[model samples]
Target: MSYSKPRNDYINAVIIPGYTYDSKILVTQCPLEETVVDFWTMVYDHNSSIVVLLDQLNRKTPLWLGRQEVLQFKDFTIVQDNSPNPEELKLILSHKEKDPMSITVFTTSKVNNDAILPSNVLLDLLKKVTECWKIQKGPITVVCSDGCSKSGIFVALKLILEKMKIDDEIDVFQVVRTMQVRRPEFFTEFDQYEYCYRCIKEYLENDSVYANL
Candidate 1:
């Protein structure tokens, strides 16, 4: 539980083990208006500096405030910063009397619930997020509508890529299996599982992609 409202310890989120790194991936559902505070609290508590949003269903409003807009949630204040990329938003999370922290939110190609993104699109987003992770050195938060579809696929693919980078090989089965053990909703549909293979095949066909990972 994050250091937020007392007795509000429950949130639809999970920390998945990372490749050669424990607790490196934080996956959670999109925050409703009521749970938005809890969502930010989780991000700050975990010291996460990067958030990847995978879809926009029911997300008519942006989670982060607009430029120069301030949202005071309990003891935390979220202030927006100028962002160059329309898809990406930057914010400073300031806790009461504590040094403010910068967080970058990356929005991927819009995807529908329980649907899959093209392999190339997925790989491109992963490259960008991985680059940011190298600097932040903190867990990356993956968000989606229910926190399991696109979030799971991205995490599994990331681990597979990391494994390939370090060991020069890939094990889609083992990676997905390990993640599914933690949350059955991961790869909930058979098509989703096949989509992982599609991503792997795409990754292998492009030599330049290897360099980015």
Candidate 2:
């Protein structure tokens, strides 16, 4: 089955935890010139469905789009001091019904935790996010911290596309370049890039074979 091409002309929005030179470069280089919304503070724009942030840390902050424009949502912070059960985390996410978009804010601790989010959980998140993009009339822009630890999300996204048999149409290079512009530190670690590349390649090959069968 073929999926429709993503509406690439829509404005791209980026979510970052804080202002950084790398993040600035990403915004400047992004292909979407007309609607590049930056979320410096924790604010949401209903007009733009895309939400980008450095990591999950800024989920609670007020989303300030521009002067006099403030969007607020129930803030959820990762439990760092004490690790909460996954059920507890799910309950926290379920509390906000107003926001149809599932919101998740995590820290590096999540990357470290072996049992925090199982591989299946990550895969499910990727599938859900892509499904959202398929239904929406616009392209999906993801903003995350730069590094190997943070690379899991993108890897998972690419896997989802591959599984759906649309990997060829996806521009992995553009995605990586856009990410590099957002987080120069991401490429500073060669190992992280290698890991991300390997993960994507493995997922694509495996999924492509599965689709063929």
Candidate 3:
């Protein structure tokens, strides 16, 4: 699917964390009302897409909006893994309809598990985002919700960008600010934010010099 020419106008890809559809309550809080025209245009013009990540907790299968019914919403490619392999994750990220202007939804088991949010997962997401940047003609927005879990994903994403040496290009503060605006209840704990920052800093400072265990 070919995307229309890119514009400076903000195009958002909302990420509602978890499997339960009840989480959609947060959508009402999004700045969609402020950017209604632009958001709708991106949707109708096929210039933007919504990428949602469903948590593994919900037994009920999640539903996505179809393209014909709406503007252009694609079903998320669920990544079901306790600890996914980097190459496998990369393959999954590459399965988009458009080469450069597509949004991806990544769902994981939990947010705070020290064992679950591995470097490989972060790397895969970063790779996808960078790939999007290379192909996308305009700025891409990633909107995440459901409190700290979504923040954790954002943290991991920032870490991956740092590892790839593109941290300067992407504004971490702006990303987090956007998340806060979307869901005021999100990132309630400062510790979670600190943890994410530490994780990214540690990875950047030591990963290159340290040998793999």
Candidate 4:
């Protein structure tokens, strides 16, 4: 499904196929100024209930942030709830119960923007991501500065661990191989690819539940 307004190719986020059983994950770029509304529209249109942001947004700009400001644009009234961590805002779109959307913003550290997220940090993040999915479910939209660079790593981890949990074993290389076919350039960098391997090993080596998983 391609977007029509503002007309562009980047507006169409890639959907990683073969996930017919679980929540759909859409790899997309961090929303631009003109596409903020369109971004939300995509989320709503796809029935995506969770958005995982992994990039730093401009603080001063209203790209959809302020101490607390609600945004209203065509069929969506998004209310921002920011308290403890302003950077991690929880959004409620439209209703208070079913079909409302939730967003969590987080960005990992990188040197010269080339390094992958630290393995330790990534493991912890994966645990938290698992917890969130358990609670909310998804067609989770994972967005980063350039869209799928960091996001792809996270998705690969999730798919591997999830399969491990079910089958009691996993083949990381195979999982990533299939992923790259669905979305080109997934885990394309050597360091990032190595980081993913380390993250899975770290989880399997230490965690008891996932060790058996």
Best by lDDT: 1
Q: Which sequence of candidate numbers ranks them by TM-score, best first?
A: 1, 4, 3, 2
List residue ranges in candidate 4 displaced over 4 A. Answer: 1-10, 17-20, 58-63, 86-88, 95-115, 208-213
Q: For residue 162, what is the lDDT in candidate 3? A: 42
The whole-model lDDT of each prediction reads: 0.81, 0.34, 0.38, 0.67
Model 4 lDDT per residue over 45-121, tens place? 67676676666654432445454687765456677776465534577666322366566543344312445667776
Instruction: Give all TM-scores, in the order shown.
Output: 0.91, 0.40, 0.41, 0.79
Give the Cα RMSD of candidate 4. Answer: 4.0
- Of candidate 4, the 10-residue stretch with the lowest lDDT total is 105-114
- Where in model 2 is the C-alpha error above 4 Å? 1-46, 50-122, 139-175, 178-186, 205-213
- Model 3 per-residue lDDT tens digits across residues 51-159: 2232232223222222322222232232223324322221111124433333433344443323335554544444444454444423233333332465445543443
User: For model 2, what is the alpha-carbon lDDT of residue 86?
Assistant: 25
Best by TM-score: 1
Q: Judging by TM-score, tell me the better candidate of 2 and 3.
A: 3
TM-score of 2: 0.40
Clash pairs detected, candidate 4: none
> What global local distance difference test value does model 3 have?
0.38
